[model samples]
Target chain A: MFSGAQVSLYPMTDDFVGVILKAITALEPYRPDFRIETDDVSTLLVGPPDQLFPAMRDLFVTAAGSGVHCVLAATVSRGCPGEPDDPICTPINDVHYGQPLEERIAAAIQQVEAAPKTGQIVAAQFSLYPLGSGHHMDEIYGCIEFLKNSGVFDRSKNFCTKLRGDAGAVFATLSEAFLRFGAPQGHVALDLKVSANSPTAV
Target chain B: MFSGAQVSLYPMTDDFVGVILKAITALEPYRPDFRIETDDVSTLLVGPPDQLFPAMRDLFVTAAGSGVHCVLAATVSRGCPGEPDDPICTPINDVHYGQPLEERIAAAIQQVEAAPKTGQIVAAQFSLYPLGSGHHMDEIYGCIEFLKNSGVFDRSKNFCTKLRGDAGAVFATLSEAFLRFGAPQGHVALDLKVSANSPTAV
Candidate 1:
């Protein structure tokens, strides 16, 4: 299966140019592992789904370490037909879809528990879109149930579900939600926002 | 009807605290018109649906004018049962939601065309969810049709539709999309991101 994301970082400072440039270097360690491109709107990162959030966490941690507030907005997707299938954009795991929903939930939880800890506590929110699914809501509800036990699950917000924890688990939880739920071959989209070192974070 | 949004601004600089404080002052002019609260996570702006975007634009423009890259993340919603009805959060316009879908589309376009121009250009993307709408994808597709002709439509992005234009028209288009589509009384949610003054802008 194919996986990738379109991400943009906004830094609130006069030296934003400097900040953004410096932050992306955090992704350098992951280079050649993914095809990355930066455009006027957002940067495109295509590669293994497992590395998507870890790469993002490294980048944001660098930005946040500047002792400034930074926000990352991203749309993570897997199995979207609109995107061209590139051999480089392949999943690292054996993803056998059509497994029973309960099994997927158990596997997803195990994955979250085993995620590497980034040690950077962050708060994130996301809304899942399971397009073309015959029973999208069922898929959504199932995901929600899995999130409640995902260790990082925060609370139910007005529109999106919230998650807070070490950057590693938070992102791992998100990756699982995006990849494991919804139709196996249908398009699934995740609207994701992550924040680090915010003054308002409780 | 209850209409409001949860918004947060992140400034990437050592002076993020100062920058955020300075920017929120812009919303001072809109005060008393809405019930606003700021917390560790975000600020809640509850008021007439029409003023939601303008208020955000004012706050964002102020932050962007500092000659830095700033990004705003917001989730706007109307008529969610989870929220309590507040007279303070009233609709400025006579929203007859049950009107024909075509009529709603026309009115939405007219609203965008008549929007007050903020003179600042910004790019925004949002995904609308008509939670209980039996035909949610149909509603999404219909919203897409309206957006193509919205004058501010930028492109069909992977997960969400993109809009770029004067802050006024761009936000107006977003407001219309959030309010006009989906089930009239059913729960509807929008996940939104807006950015300005980015060095990466083409």
Candidate 2:
């Protein structure tokens, strides 16, 4: 299934231009593993689903490392029916794709537990969409349940769920939510916003 | 039906605090029409759906008038089954609800045509979720058709659709897209991000 994200980073400083440019270089190592394109609005990273979070994590960690308030906005999707599949994002199979809801939740939790620690702490909120499906609510509810047990779950807001923890685990939780709950090979997306070193009291 | 939005404004300037505080004053007039609250992360606005866009438009216009880069992030929703209905946001009846998709698209276009031009130019991108319905994509595709004719339609990006025009038409387009698509009584959501005077090349 095809999967990708359009990501933009904002640094809250007069030196924003330098911070943003320097941070994007973190995606360089992942270039061979994915197809990355940058435009005026955002950077599009397309390729395998598993490599996606790590790439984003590095980009964010690098930017946040500047010790200035920073925010990253990302729109992530997988298996969108309307979008054509790309060979670079293919050949990968999810063993738990067709598992029962309970089983999938269990598998997702295990994935998060094994995620490598990136050390940087961050807060994130995301609204997931499992589109064109009759049982979308069930999937969303199940995702909520999984998130609560993911150790990074913070709280549920009006339009999205919040999470906070090490960047590694936080990104892992997001990855599982986007992949596990929605119908595999169907249209699904996540409207993700993340902040690191935010000045506001949280 | 219940409707509300969680909105966060980001002013891309060193004096962000001043810009945000000054822009918030624009919401005062709409306070009588909606229940409003501000926290560290965002401002919560709940009220009649029709008035939502106007309130947001004024806020954006005020901030953009400062001639600094600004971005507004809003998560808007209506008729969510999981959320309790608030009386403050009640009594809204969309006349076009339950109509054929084509008719709804035409109605939405009409609404945009009558929108008041705010003179502030803006660009926005939003993803609408009409959850748990088998025809969700049909509604989404229908919305796409409406946006193309909305007078604010920009180009469609990878994860969300973009719009650019006077703040009035852009915001009106967003309101119509939310109210006109999806099941009126079922859960629906929009992840909206709008930019005004963005210093970066758009």
Candidate 3:
């Protein structure tokens, strides 16, 4: 079982570079338990459930607190039959492999900070897989019901719901959903993504 | 902003009661900030993102570390046009609301501990909503790609993927996906769920 996620953030302000840097930097504290990698498209976090969730929560919360509209997109996966039994998939209780997570993340963020600022807003897409549990569709429906009852889901749209206003609130909602659906009975995996923004000026 | 998540854990072992009790008790330290509520169905933690996420992380890690197969289902949401500005939704920086989370969680866990043990595995369903962003379909695609590449997505199924094996690995993957997609740009929401089981005799 290999667990990992790729995350992309789009900050809707001139200081977008700063916001992204701050978000990535926040994960530095969790370096002891996580292995983080960043490329041009997204940043990847690999580690145990305990460390990974808390680190991600902290990262997103820090980024959202910048008081600017932004969107964070990610895709998480585990229990793939196809995954290779390499060092990267080693259990958390074992010795770590590869470069230190904090240094890698810091270097990546620095590069982003130094890059020329882009005034344009970013829009990206994401998905999750292996949402199987023999009754995946049912579980998906149940998850939808749970979200609807939570009061954060707007039913006005066709496939996606609108999460408006505060960034903290949005992150909270997303965190809950991911934790619940991660390891379902009968071995289920999921695919999901979002495009978020502050309310546009009316 | 107020951030919160409602989690329900179903352990597929005879010691289900103990597992749930231990997980809830794990959050006692964060009583200062969270408002925790538990019924027969789920435990809801509402507060600042900082407190809520850390608390949930601790709880799940403790439960998963027990080495029993369990399914933890949750739904998270925030900032919807339909949500009432009740005390539960109050910002973390504001005055307190309701009873203390620690006391409530303790009482609930105690009740579970006292209940007669049911030696049956639990199967449940959950859903999340407000996954509305005009381009939700695209985000879904992105999430799928990320999961596929993560090496844990079980593509054996037609519509969903299967995440099996260690609870920690499954949790790590799900947590990453939820945190990322929960708040995408253009105001998107999500829906998902899971079911898990301990390793059966070969």
Candidate 4:
């Protein structure tokens, strides 16, 4: 059965939701074995992951159709807001693509260590997506729970993630975290530079 | 004068490139300042930053216009391929957007940091966007040079980059790096999930 998912599109912060809506509408012609819906913020299409791929291709091809050029982001899922009927309401670990928050937190720490500048640790800020404002601490604590529950690593000491390594390592670490969280597949905008104390390698 | 920056989109894999291309094509109407040039493995779009933003918007709209959504990686830049008469033949500290190899490497780091597994440390497996195809080391080195020269942060020992506090600081540091070496501003797509990791104070 196709999992019901809420797919939202962030188009550089604009009321440009119509494009995706149009694509979703176009899917009707394909006779997909799934139910699809569209709104201003996202297009919720329901179907097996396999079926979704082809329908998505058609939508991408026509809407983002060739000869046009632009950047984009999208998501797919099932379930509705209100109450907690959807499996997504539960912690990510409980979901199909979910990874324990502890795993994510540990990954963040390891990411810091893996940075190209592993020895010289500096200012680093790690965050979980969709935690929303006024709730970062609560969200972080939840992550700790996942960590403790999962016998992957021990959170014996006060574990705070600090970015280490060179620019390369720092950037690499960030990517891993996003993937682990099952970040909505989208483009990545990155900017990184080497430290001044480093050699004149450039 | 308009900055003729070259923007190249490098998807994690060749398969992903097709989707990216569709997103770009959909953006064509909006991105008047730039022109798209397609190569075998990548697509190059040259234009100014002002126009690039909207173009990027369209691209993301188109991608989100589809169903696959995520911000795996994205970048912006201020330079383009050098002319034969160009004095430096691409300045050692120069950063441009047309290059994909450098951005891909940077993105690999980002994925590592964001993923919840692998300890968030980008293993060699995820070190390069197009894994196993070694090329563009010089460009990567160029980015390192640009980061060091650009006075975006304080020079701390190790791989530390001193910036303002929290989100602003990270944003600023990344902005400088992208403006100098990133491709035209655009939305990137990747799979991301927002989860609460911390436990609430019961």
Candidate 5:
């Protein structure tokens, strides 16, 4: 089965460019575990759910820790027979695939040091495709149950949830649910978007 | 504050038209209290959250009772100073609004008597905007906590949660959160869409 996700992050701050750079830097440690690609619209991560979900949790936690509203939009998929089997999709065997985490962070900071700053709420939307699972509905149900138990879901506005305060707890809850849903047995796929520090409805 | 939501419903069965009509008819009783309009793409409901949330709950619960996969996408909003003060946004004072529930259902069924039939999974997406609240973030956070306690949220895929099996419970959880967010104190607004009986990821 092919499993992967595309994610976009928006930090609600005057220094949104810097904040976004910081978030990308936060994921430097896990770059070796997954194929990470960044474009103007989003960052795409291709890997097994085990690596992808945790990396996502870390990224969100780090971004949210800045005390600015941030919205993350992502679409996750598994069991995609149509997806290509490219180098990016292939698993990495290297135990050490990149530079040290500190070095990566330093490089990222240096790269964005000259960027302009603006304070704006980040609004994003995503869709996930968990295709070809006979028990797709069941997996969705299970995943929802997990989120309800995680204490981060905002039920008032459809599937959009809010994560605030105590970043450690928020990350733990989010990662746990992601890992469980990515389990082989569930055969789940997900799509999502979150807006943090948004001044208006996203 | 002007509060409203836009919803789209998809039923995973071939009898989608009938199912949708049935759901709409279910809300006839509250028509006077809410300004409800239906176009090709979606149905819009505007009113106080107190009345609007419960009405939506009943409609979704009735639709989900068919044992077919359904997805609802909605965007909810409150405190929109820019929204026009149209009749739809106006609160109704009528003691008697529309026909009795049975008559409305019968009418809806008759209108869709020629629809076809099939079974599939429903997929949908939605966004909610609870604007102009000093505690907007806090209210969102509170609503998320409420959903986490309610046991219907799926934490694995950001805010995307699933609703399956036991239509009653699903509706209850959904309505409760909507109502809480729509509470007068929170000054919230909402928008949404729903799909039932769809077969693919939405």
Candidate 6:
């Protein structure tokens, strides 16, 4: 079963996708069985882990050559994003790889909680590109709604409460989320901070 | 005399550029005098900083709301990337930002001589990206040529005989070279490393 992979390319511009596409194709020699489907700026590849890992390695090496920088979100298990009706038979969730606003927030919170410090707020911030490509406001609203209803966080809290727990638990949750939304070669920056409430130079 | 303000928006896909344009135009109320241009995935806005700041602020706010995460790079300079015919009113060689890369390196070495730890190279790495549009191999050879001619790094006898500077410095140099080549938004992300040899993180 295939999971999700999220990738990011720096100097993100029009021709970056071409470079990413080229990198994916180059990986075919390494992971011949995986299917690669690209739509606009995002791409999805589904296959067994053994094949997928090599494919990803080839992608990184080739992208680096093209001045591309990428981050793989995680390996997924079920669902993949493709054409709406022609959904690819992959194990990654389409919603997570695309405009994964809600899942990202949840993952951020989970990551922070997993590694809480004396005066640190474990937090993650994410950016998305949903202005075009038929992304509707309703779908975004639904994601927000689902997040609110997921009961993962208490909405009634005065401020977003900091969840305290083991890093393993937090990581597991984040890993699960990554499985759903990670893409092959898109730009996503994940900063794990143990910043104090008041600023102090590191 | 408007100190030109430059705004570069990078979208993951060309299709997303249209919506980004709409968001930028929506900021017309905030920056009425803003002049905008699009050549590929980058949208360059040149105008007065007073008006440009708010326009940029508005555009980022809307983009965030729309789920498009962006990494913004800006500068307020005396000249704009206005037109091809316009002679650069600002002197090209002024070290307005900082000493030339070579000068900076020399100063660092001298300072390190006084205090050995100052020049102690902590880390060093180098990377390149194509200039302008980045669809094809850019003549980054010019940057390589600059580094070679500048006598910046002592190829021998130095504890850290390598390029280790801030990511910003590296990019700025590369960007300047591309501009000299008459390529707008044709740039690449430089993979760099920092050392105690330099002042900032590479």
DockQ values, each candidate = 0.36, 0.61, 0.02, 0.02, 0.03, 0.06
lDDT of 6 by residue, A68-140 (tens): 3222222122321111222233433233334456655565445434532222121111111111112222333
How many backbone collisions does model 3 have? 51
Cα displacement (angstroms), candidate 6, residue B81, comes to 15
lDDT tens readout by residue for model 1, B1-202? 6778888887656677788889999999889899887766678898987688788888888887776666788877777654678887777667777777788888889998998877788888777766644477777887888899899998876556778889888888888888888877766668777777666676
Best by TM-score: 2
Native interface contacts kept by each candidate, as a fraction: 0.36, 0.60, 0.00, 0.02, 0.00, 0.11
* lDDT, model 1, position A200: 68
TM-scores of chain A across the candidates, in order, are 0.93, 0.96, 0.62, 0.32, 0.61, 0.33
lDDT of 2 by residue, B124-151 (tens): 8888888778888788899999999998
Model 4 Cα lDDT, one tens digit per residue, B12-131: 222344666576676657444445554221233445433443344345434433344323222233322111122222232233445565564464335323422111111000010110
Model 4 residue runs over 4 Å out of place are A1-202, B1-18, B69-76, B79-81, B84-202
Q: Where is model 1 more than 4 Å wrong at Cα?
A: A1-3, A29-35, A47-50, A79-90, A97-102, A131-141, B1-3, B28-35, B46-48, B79-90, B99-102, B130-138
Q: What tens digits encode model 2's per-residue C-alpha lDDT throughout A1-202? A: 6789988787766677788889988988988878887765677888988777788899999999998877788888888767788888863544457778999999999999999998889988888888878777789899999999999999898777889989999999998888888887788888888888877747
TM-score winner, 1 or 5: 1
Sorted on DockQ, best first, the list reads: 2, 1, 6, 5, 4, 3
How many clashes in candidate 1?
Answer: 4
Q: After superposition, how far is residue A82 of candidate 4 from its true place, in Å?
A: 47
List ranges where model 5 is wrong by over 4 Å: A84-130, A133-135, A151-165, A182-187, A194-202, B1-202
lDDT of each: 0.79, 0.84, 0.44, 0.32, 0.47, 0.33
Q: What TM-score fits each model? A: 0.84, 0.94, 0.38, 0.23, 0.39, 0.26
Q: Is candidate 2 or candidate 4 better by lDDT?
A: 2
Best of the two (2, 5) by lDDT:
2
Q: Each model's number of backbone clashes?
A: 4, 0, 51, 100, 55, 25
